[model samples]
Target: MVQNSTDPVGWEHFDHDADVGVRGIGVTQAQAFEQAALALTSIVTQIESVEPRQRIDISAENGDPELLFVDWLDALIFEMATRRMLFSRYKVDIEGERLSARAWGEPVDVNRHQPAVEIKGATLTELKVEEQDEGQWLAQCVVDV
Candidate 1:
């Protein structure tokens, strides 16, 4: 289900047993990828509380779009775990099965941005990347927390 946000491009979370599912919808594949990253961030903390103070570059490649989506999310999860940061903004560029992007946010502030869970990784469960009817693209997968 889509979130109740005013923007046409947005993200949403869904139930997936012990894990959580993150979904992104937008007019373009890149936009959907960006929104999906936001959804991933929201799993950790309130996205609005994460200021875009630093930027991190990330890239991934795969022949299949679905696998690429998993790679993308895994890359973000790796960054978050290693850097101890939470991203609030993302700029994604996709060409074929290759993806390059920049994520912007600050280091985690426990008091200001209370984290809810630590995402271990993105899983193949319910993995999907496709363009829906009406020209909307969607990217989604279940994340292990």
Candidate 2:
């Protein structure tokens, strides 16, 4: 069963016992990755609540798509932790094994943002990057929160 939906480019949360499963679906692989990042932010607070007051540029490279996906999300997690921010908007461009992304969000406001939990990192467990027969793409993994 699906939990959350955001249409066109959207994310969903799946059950994972102690952890949460974040999945992104889109018409393209890059879009899927972008959506997955949304799922990551959603873990803490409502994505709609985040104001795009800041923009951060992040890039990651890997030889495999699955590993690349993990690296991409990990980079975002690092930025969030270090910058003390929550990202809501993301634009990802993937070429071969290289990924260039720009995330937009503002500093975390405890009262306004009301973040629920801190996301520790993205794990490789249940990691997948696959294209559907209908031409859409899916990116998912169990995030360590």
Candidate 3:
């Protein structure tokens, strides 16, 4: 089943049993975090209309990509909650497992970007990063909307 049409960030049931869990996938860890952030944005406002002008860099250890991914999203959330900043587009660099990502977007404008819901947090549920034999990383994440 679906949750709400108002949410801009797309989300689907994790399984047939309960609707508590949802999943989002991307081509890389950075993309995955970007998608997850979009999901949160969709919940808050119309993501399609969110202008992608703000830019910043996010880098962390290579030991745990998952933890880094969470930190990445948290940074975005903090930007919004504290400074009311929102971001679009994620450029991530991963060597072995270390991550250095850059996000591009602009500050949140209540009149312009009508956020639908507040993103409480992004979790580690069903977190995964793998390859499709082509060598490109595929990152999957489930964030709490």
Candidate 4:
């Protein structure tokens, strides 16, 4: 799990055979989504090693929260592959079925980033977006690595 000592928001990875599961926890759905993106980035490189030198905007819409979460991750994966970048920071806004966000990172430096794996896409396996407690939200899914 990736977390700040004073922050309740965090991200984690779980075993999923050949692939991997990414999960995020936060006080709000938007925060959970942002943490999920961090989890995705962590799968490839240490989040602390990345510099937020560039910013990219992303948007996705789906009536179902679970499906929308998948779209968000897949969008990030697409951006990473096409731009040869790794994002370390993210800000997300959710209104109804729509999601709008911005991600910040720099072009991958193999010597510095040391990416462990390339994520092909986010999958529906174990997909979930739910409020687990009165003030806590969780977002998660299995990713094709």
Candidate 5:
């Protein structure tokens, strides 16, 4: 998908065997996490189709950014599975190793959402989080389906 200059935060899928790979890019680490969550949501359905009717709070902490990304995504997966919801909007804040975030989405509508697959959890395989020379942050990992 094409990312607009006005909104530097975006997510994409990379080829992976059996599972799917998700990558998020943004100007800040928080934005990258938010975008990565979006990527995870997109794996199941078109994110734009999900309504922001309900709000969910999520948080995670890890000494390393890569592990933090995995924790963040895993928390989201737990919420989505338990709530039977799909999140399209996210706002994240990171202070040191702790991350606080809010995700907004409604319960799944099978007819409208047309979800493709059930995402089990985020995995450490191919995981990475880093800042580029141009100052943008990237967070990525493969998720089990």
Candidate 6:
């Protein structure tokens, strides 16, 4: 189970397993993806100041929704860490559990996009993806960040 303190989107882990495991949430899968990115951003920086001014189109497919979620977040994190960029907008087109999404942001600078934590990678513990009757998709992923 996951709990929230005050954040609109975030991730947490069970005790004793701590950083080795993590859990994330959002109102929708796309939102969850964004939140997961935010959590990653939180790990790498203050987040609130990280300006999202650039955009990129990314499309990936996988049979497993759980793995797909992890892979999606990993790709974004990899771009951020390796490319040093910050994005503020996301547009995801999901069909049959596959995602074709676009992310918008700009390069991170020491003055603007200072990362808060080093997210090593995404994990697979307790990962899940489910759609609610209300029409929202929820994806939970345990990232190594």
* Tens digits of per-residue lDDT for model 6, 1-145: 2446454455544333455444455556666666555555555566567566677877778887777788787788777778778666666666766788888777777766665566677777667776653544456555664
Of 3 and 5, the candidate ranking higher by TM-score: 5
Error of 4 at 2 (Å): 4.8
**Residue-wise lDDT of candidate 1 within 1-145, one digit each (tens)?**
4566655689999998899999998889889999999999999998999999999999999999999999999999999999999999999999987999999999999999999989999999999999985668899999999
User: In order, what lDDT does every prediction score?
Assistant: 0.92, 0.90, 0.59, 0.94, 0.91, 0.65
Error of 5 at 84 (Å): 0.3
- Could you give me the TM-score of model 2 versus the true structure? 0.94
Off by over 4 Å in 1: 5-7
The C-alpha TM-scores of every prediction are 0.95, 0.94, 0.68, 0.96, 0.95, 0.73
Estimate, for each residue in 4-71, the C-alpha lDDT of model 3 and write its tens digit.
Answer: 43333333335423212334344554554555555555556666576777677776674776677666
Q: What lDDT score goes with residue 113 in model 4?
A: 91
Candidates sorted by TM-score, descending order?
A: 4, 1, 5, 2, 6, 3
- For model 4, the stretches where C-alpha displacement exceeds 4 angstroms are 2-7
lDDT of 5 by residue, 1-145 (tens): 5266446678888879899999898999998999888999999999889999999899899999999999999999999899999999999999999999999999999999999998999999999999874658999999999
By lDDT, is 3 or 6 better?
6
Once model 6 is optimally superposed onto the true structure by TM-score, how far is the C-alpha of residue 119 displaced, in angstroms?
Answer: 1.8
Against the correct fold, how does model 1 do in TM-score? Answer: 0.95
Residues 10-106, candidate 4: write the lDDT tens digits: 9889889899999988899999999999999999999999999999999999999999999999999999999999999999999999999999999
| Candidate 6 regions with alpha-carbon error over 4 angstroms | 1-27
Q: Candidate 2: global Cα-lDDT?
A: 0.90
